[model samples]
Target: MGMGGMRRQGSDFEPEFFRIFRSIEDQQKRSAWLQAEGMLAAAPMLRARGLPLAADDPGEVSLEAERAAAEQQMLEALVRSGVPFLLAGPSLAAWTLYPEPGRRPRESMDLMIHARAVNDARAILRDEDFVPDPRGATRTESAQAWRRSKASVQLSIRLRWDFCDHPILNRRFSIAGLQAKSVVIEKPVAGLRALGVEHATLYSALRWVDAVHERFRLVDLFDQDLRWRMLGKEKLAELALLARQRGVAGILAEHLGMARRVFGTPVSTELLHSLKQSGNHERSGSLLGAGRGRMRYHLLGALYGRGLRVRGRHLFSLISPG
Candidate 1:
């Protein structure tokens, strides 16, 4: 189902927000889960509407300062190690959403750095006591035990990836490529770096499609919506052109439509119409559109990519298996 069809009656967030909310029968368990997701602030609103509530719910505890310090520590370590990185996904989104992470806490910070720096980044994070949770079988992990599911966003494992969703998306896109074409945004923290208006907007849409198609997580849509609202019309025009150049504008338009419909985010309708006009050139709807088997994701990838090269490069991306 598209996001609209997935909504349960009471959820103001993603449908899985309520799907997981309703699944827990115990009040404190629900409260704890909400606290962990950073949604405990909604407790009063939910209770006023006569939903279940725990009378003894704890006082609001903000994790922003602590998270900021931890993020600073890790980034400093990476920079010291000479590894260039981009604060990616939730970590990148946190800069604008500062002092409030909205409905979900960034249980893990995301980093997408040069492919050459993966091992060094992994080691630096480990030295800082950030345990690396390396996952490669995106093509093989089961649905019920899928580690990235909405219900299991945090497993008390405190897991973090050395590279931001790299195993899944880095296979398709690259940090160096993004850095080459992208403008840099202001560093939120001392060592923090990210793509500026144009590139950040493009990448977030790309990630949004991958996350939703895999049924992996709704939080990514929140990230995309965050980027969309920050990029006003002119920059978005730049994004639309960049996306078409990248061959993802068509599929991105459809997913951006989902972000708009669900979050009431201010994505331009005219821009979306322009994006959809790409038609056959848009690669994702055929390549990674939802429900295709894993084998097809690998096969179709070789057929096209942003800024196509000779077939050999595409074939290398398919078989090299990051």
Candidate 2:
């Protein structure tokens, strides 16, 4: 079919799709979703839980400076500890794909370390004065907090370090597999590092599916938008194939469909149609319901439970306030 005809056929639910897309794009809706998920506060919110910010100087400039210092210290500590690791999450996103100044600055840095080196890395973090936040962390134990010093910003900055070999959506993704497929590149500020754009993109898509299935969050949708913009037709084709191989074709197709309809994200019409044909019809219906509200999406998740395999514990971690 021609591209125009294909777009029409592919977007049969455009009205409902865009409605949901715009809702997620709305800042108020996004904030409400983050607040509901308990991720809205990075460090300042943790003050009540004993990890106080620089109470005397809580200005944005101070906070930004502290965060920058903390990130540099954390990276230095990781290197000093001799632990093999790769940067992921928003920091990496900023480094590689989305360089928009208006994009929200990440609250923490996410690092994936070799499984065997996790203990050593943890020890290094502890020596650096970093401690576990234990707020929203569940299956994968992510470390947070450094020290409570006025000079160091009082442990306000947080870092999440996870073992490279871990389960995402209940599926195992090994570090070796990641390293083999990841694109190695040099960062202007951070030097040479592995940029797992493909893996990160796929992971973001899966996270978005989980958000729809559990609680609707704007950050997840925003992440999808960022990663989607970073990828091209070749990369997306590879990602689609990876999702199929990883048993997440339905989930990928559903979110890609939503992104295409809402953000006008670039996705091949042919690719979308093929994925939809191979994916679950139930999920397609759920995606349509998701644009309406949380209740509809939850009902669909309860009814279908197909497409992606999100562990019960993982689902709890996504929704639970940490």
Candidate 3:
């Protein structure tokens, strides 16, 4: 209980997610902002207060409908062509991870497949009018931007052969290992699957820590608390080992501490202590006690060579926000 209390007394690196969330004093305006940004990850909390949502414009609703239909067509094409894949990211997670999903609309959806079958999968998407994003290859996988030839489907599909897109970070997890633990989807979207609970916990933690943002990714970070709760105690013992083995224990532990600090995620006190005590550099107050910015740029860089280019890209964006 002592450890579970927020660790940072006065840290400048603290996330402003809830600070900004609470600052939105008017419930009406807050709901509108959430809807416009498609940050439906906050739906359960909003519903608890019985807040009325700002309605969508009819044009936007029509566009969303078209996108949904296009997405379904893309999925049907994949299934019909027998392209085995796993539905990933917020597209599925947002819909299924929480007690009541808000079906957050996505301009892009992610799916993973075997490297050998990437072309085959692309062909199926092409047949359905999707085309390779002209922006070209990613560090880890190819992308298929949904062709907005007529109605502006407002969709992009990522064809991933691996989970972590970072070249340096690719060693963290495996497509094969995650796929082995994947759970099948049965309704609304058939022939699709998502990461299992243990995997979701790790993946979400990784994303939380690895992410670099101008504005804190409020919805995704909010997801950390939810997924952490879903993880429960039975498998709690394995998370530290998994995090350690995958080389993310220190960084993930640090971010988990941040989550506990910020969100009051309702995880057991022992969890944070266990992660820090997992016998990584975390125990030495190296990564675990570091500030969020320091941990992101320095600890992760030294551990996995992740920061130089990423930091440069972020700086460039800051300098040129056009």
Candidate 4:
């Protein structure tokens, strides 16, 4: 359902705020402030109304446990090697939503590391024959090749190939002021494992760009929040503002929306307000009008246009005075 249909009653932030945030003009600054206000405002109102927010619930907690289990092993391995890495994309999301792996994974553990580290990771996995694709061609070509090979390998296990050598991969991995810190993931049978945070956050956001067709997963956002929390809300607010200035508010918003939809929680209002202020509403909307495949593409484009800006900001940050 659209944002309007998704609103649960008693939410202090009006659903309209989201709709407007999706389609506003020149109020990137204003929307962001309002978003923060709404979030701060929501807490008391929600408390007064006795409404429950989904930050930590049983199902979510269970899922996090499963994700944690799956992640710790991989992380501990990376840490042992002294790899300069960070958790990015689905893995972080899964970790946030469910800190341990379950009987099954909602999504594979995706990690983002400096470009220099890809070969290192590939080397580690190579003993198991998990080598990186050497097509040296565009991702589209690789995806096609993978599809052709799908008959031989389990499609899901092989899906990781499509993710290799992605253009966005570079941006997320080589972000300015990039840093790493360890997070613990639990393995029911194996004790604890360690993973990097910075890389994981970038990867998770980048994953949203490609996983356009997959079912929206809320756990990712929960992870984003957790990653953001680890990174510090101050940085999130700074990035949110920077993302807007770069014209990526729409992209960030869409991803934030996906997080809300999947996880049943809103992204930080402060971050939202910052993005809204950055996004010029006059230019936002369903650019493709209406069509079958077009809806996703249109929405994706609106978001990407904004994302390019955010990415651009990161690019600039990488070089700017610290």
Best by lDDT: 3
TM-score attained by model 3: 0.72
lDDT of 4 at 76: 62
**Mind giving the per-residue lDDT tens digits that candidate 3 earns over 1-322?**
0233455434453334455556688976776666665554445464554444444445544555566676666677677777778777666665575443334555466787777788888777777667666542332232334443344556778776766644345556677777887887764467667777666766666555433432344456566666776775666667767777766665566667656666656555566666666636433233234365422433344444345664454344344422
TM-score of each: 0.63, 0.61, 0.72, 0.49
Q: For candidate 3, list the clashing residue pairs, or say none.
A: none
Off by over 4 Å in 1: 1-65, 101-104, 134-174, 181-188, 212-217, 288-322
Better of 2 and 3 by TM-score: 3
Q: What TM-score does candidate 1 get on C-alpha atoms?
A: 0.63
User: Per-candidate RMSD vs. true structure?
Assistant: 8.1, 10.2, 6.2, 12.9
**lDDT string, candidate 4, 1-322, tens digits:** 2433333435554444344434545454533433333232122222333533323234433553544553464456656676554444454444443423331234344443554565666555443334343331222221211111222222111222223223323232232234424455443323233344433443455455544345543334445654554566665656565455434465465556555543344466555555655554513322211342324443334344335654453344334442
Summed over model 2, clashes come to 3
> TM-score rank, highest first?
3, 1, 2, 4
Which residue pairs clash in candidate 1?
none
lDDT of 4 at 122: 56
- Please write out the lDDT profile of model 1 over residues 1-322, one tens digit for every residue: 2454322223354344455677899877887776654556445534654557665233353344455455555566766677776655566666554434333345555555665666666565556544434442222211011122232123212222321222233334556665565444455445456666565665666555444224344555656766776676677777777667767777677777766665556666676777888835644556444554444554554443333442344455456645
Clashes of each: 0, 3, 0, 43
For candidate 2, lDDT tens digit of each residue in 1-322?
0112224435344533234424576665654544443234333322433432333223443454455555666666666556777676655664555332113345556666555776777677667666665542433333343342334454333333432212334333566566566664554334435547778876566545433323443444556665887777788778877777765676677677666654456666778778766666433434433264444444444443333442343444345453
Arrange candidates, best lDDT first: 3, 1, 2, 4
Instruction: Output the better candidate (1/2) by TM-score.
Output: 1
Whole-structure CA lDDT of model 2:
0.51
Q: Which has the better TM-score: candidate 2, or candidate 4?
A: 2
